[model samples]
Target: MQALLQEAASRLHAIEDRLTVRTQIAAAVAAMSIALVSTLAAGAAIISYRHTAALIESSVAGIASSTSARLDRFMATRRQEMKLFTELEPMQRLWQGDPTELRSALEALQRNFDFTWIGFADLNGNVVASTGGLLQGKSVAARPWFKQGLENVVVGDVHEALLLASLLTQRANNEPYRFVDIALPVRDTSGKVIGVLGGHLDWTWASNLIADVQANDGNTDTRLSILSKGGMVLVGPKRETIRYGGDELADMLKVRDGTFRETVDGQQMLTAFHVGNGYRDYQGLNWIVTAS
Candidate 1:
């Protein structure tokens, strides 16, 4: 009887010892698991921080690029404005055999502006003085630009002008290269209107201007041109060749009053239009400037 009782106690003690060992093993595993989880979480946080920092740096770089581009445009515009005031102003004042003024204006308009030709037209649409080749002594009586100027009854303000055969100077190959005319009205000191002061605009220079303006901008395809309401090509004349007498032209006519943007032929175009009215010296002309 004593031996049986001792055997039963010994078995109970062994069972208790086995349970304590199992509990200790579970606790150790749980502690190790917590440490592993903590280490993984710290690694994830560090990675997230690095990603955020990289994004911030990229954003800052974009902003800096935008700022630099804007500054460049501002500088270019300022330079052009200065040239207009300092160089063009004096030339504009000279008239009637003031060869120096005419020469100065001509040089500035052609060489500096990259225009192919320069000329003056009377209120009656007579050619006064022409500088450069192939246009001297040419009669412009039948030209659309002259007729439009007569019809509109205003001059002097800059607007787009058109060209007709014999009105424009012939190119070196004798092929007529049409150009947009940037014309204003000429006036006497008494503000009496005399004629239209006009010159040719180089499309290449104009393209450069557009590229400069768009160096940092997106979402806008622009055109700078001169045209009649009837879809005549003046400046950037090639545009008319591609889109003659279509719904595209109809869309353009809708926004001739101010600077605006529209989609034509599945492309975005920003445009600014102005009709010529001579408040200074030029009077009585209907001309338009379109910048898209």
Candidate 2:
């Protein structure tokens, strides 16, 4: 009986060992399954992170490119405008005295500047003199531009060269010419209107100026012109002759002002208005000059 009891005890011990070993194996398998799932989850998170980072980089690059393009354009335009104004400053200074000096300066201007015509008009709106073509000393007193000056106290009339192109027929060739005119008012120290200082400019100079204004970036063509106080069109291309006193410029007449941009007929024009101080120490009969 003792032997039989010992044998039973050994059998029970073997059975208990086998159960322990199976439990340990099951625990190891469960742990390995959990580790594999966690690894896959980590890899998916990394891929998502990479995708988000790429999108952010692309957005930033696009914005930077757009900003750079706009900035480049603005700087280019400002530079060209500045250069043109500088060229006119010396002529303005010489206009304050000696009608002869003004005439001589105009002669020099015609020779040195890029225009098919350069001339002057007296306070009565008559063409006193001109250089560079047959229009010199020709009477333009009857022209609408002249009439507009007579009515307005102190503002410039800007317009296209075409209005005055009738005077620029070639001597031997049937070639047509173009120009830009800036009809400035001549003033004395007493701030009185004396006469008008006119600039007959070559279209090339202005066109070159517009080209140089890098901000334009070939987006649109630009034209420059001055309007009378009543909003009459003084300068531009493809302009039709309109009656003076009844125009928009006459109705919107205002004080002397300078520098603005507007759109006309699908084109952009940047302009400057040199408003006159009527007849105070003025060097001419038309308008006074005061750094406008």
Candidate 1, superposed: residue stretches over 4 Å from native = 1-94, 98-105, 147-178, 209-292
Candidate 2: C-alpha lDDT: 0.46
- Per-residue CA lDDT of model 1 for 158-219, tens digit only, reads 23334435545455776445444444456665667666555554444434544564453344
**Model 2 Cα shift for residue 216 (angstroms):** 13
> How high is each candidate's TM-score?
0.40, 0.36
Tens-place lDDT digits, model 2, residues 5-104: 9999999999999989998899999999999999999999999988885654443333323332332233333323323432465655554445566566
Clash numbers, per candidate: 15, 50
**Reference-based lDDT, residue 166, model 1:** 58
lDDT for position 21 in model 2: 93
Task: Give residue 77's error in model 2 in angstroms.
Answer: 12
Query: Candidate 1 lDDT (Cα, whole model)?
Result: 0.51
